[model samples]
Target: MSRLTAIIAAVVACLIFCLGWLAMHYHNAASKQQTRAESAEQQVNAAEAVTSNVLTTMTIFNTISEANQHAKEQIALDASGASADIKVAVASDDCALRSVPDGAVKRLQQYADGLRQGAGGSATGKPDS
Candidate 1:
């Protein structure tokens, strides 16, 4: 009878040890899974941020392009009455200042100034020519 009781006690001890080992294994697996899930979530957020930035940049670029086209059209309309053989004087030296502005050069400078003003007037780079 004593020997049988000893055998039963040994079996209970073995069962308890096995349960503890299984619990530890489950905890380790759960921890690893949680870490992986967090990493995946972080990556998704980063990708979304990058996509949003790229889209915003593209929108700005398109706006600037449209404004530039509009400015070109305005300039063309304004210059319609100008002679086809318009002469633009060129400075031989970069440091030299022209004594008098050529007709075409003066118009170009005026257009540039208009463009600067328009760009400052709004977010878009449209010139108020």
Candidate 2:
């Protein structure tokens, strides 16, 4: 009877130890899962913010493009000798100009260069009369 009692005690101890180990393991796994979920949420939020910013920038760019086109048209019309000074004044206003597209400023500079050359040629008596 004494031996039997000792064996039973050992079995109960082993069972208790296993239960405690399982509880600890479960707690650790739950903590890791929670951390991963929070990390993923943060990433998603960052991505959304980036997307929203890009969209806003694109909208602003589009608005600028449209305004630039309108201004250019007005300039062209004024170049035809209709209220030239007014058109030039409007175009000269910084706020009236659109945010030039990437590389567009270079193209504009090129056009300006051409105009300068033409003006110089005309002034030098090389007009294509």
Candidate 3:
């Protein structure tokens, strides 16, 4: 009877050890999965921020293009009957001190000339004359 009781005790100990090992493996797998999910979320956030910045820059560029077109139309109308020298001097802005502003002024002048030369004020860089 004592030998039978010892055999039963040994079987119970083996089952308890197996259960503990299985629990540890399950915990490790769950931790790895959580880390991967967090990394993916961070990448998605970074992509969204970049897209938002690009959109803002494009909006500002479009606004500048429209303003340039409007300036060209008004200058041409004001200088329609004036001499060539007077037309060249029109739309001269005092705040233009940089190279970029110089380029903008040059672009406006070309547009104004196109409008007066019977091309109808277009700034699409196509030859109107």
Candidate 4:
């Protein structure tokens, strides 16, 4: 009777040890999975942030390009009109040539030529022969 009781006691101790080991094993596996999930989430967030920045940068570049093109076109138009106005005023005696500095007129012509070339506009403000 003592031998049977000792055997039963040993069996219960072994079961308890097994159950504890299994619980610890499962707990470690769950912790590892949680860590991997968290890492994946961080990676996803980083990718999203990078994508957003890239899109914002592209939009800014596009806006700047458009603004530059528009400004160039406007400058070209203004140059052509100024030269034309000068020629008309001279011919009609609306303003004297001396009143308009030759140096300023030359600089304006140069600037207008560059703007027209860049903007792809035909030169229409030729001085009267």
Mind sharing the TM-score for model 4? 0.64
Q: TM-score each candidate.
A: 0.61, 0.59, 0.55, 0.64
Ranking by TM-score: 4, 1, 2, 3
RMSD of 3: 13.2
For each of the candidates, the C-alpha root-mean-square deviation to the true structure, in angstroms, is 10.5, 13.3, 13.2, 8.4
Residues 53-74 of candidate 1 have per-residue lDDT tens digits of 9999999999999999999998
Writing each residue's lDDT as its tens digit, candidate 2 over 66-129 gives 9999999988887777666667878768766767686767756665666777756434544335
Q: Give the Cα lDDT of each candidate.
A: 0.80, 0.84, 0.80, 0.86
Task: Tell me which of candidates 1 and 4 scores higher on TM-score.
Answer: 4
Higher-scoring candidate on TM-score, 2 or 4: 4
Indicate the TM-score of model 2.
Answer: 0.59
CA shift of 57, model 3, Å = 1.4
**Positional deviation of 28 in candidate 1, in angstroms?**
0.4
User: How many pairs of residues in model 4 come into backbone collision?
Assistant: 0
Model 4 local distance difference test score: 0.86
Ranking by lDDT: 4, 2, 3, 1
Q: Model 3: per-residue lDDT, tens digit, 1-75?
A: 999999988998888999988999998999999999999999999999999999999999999999999999887
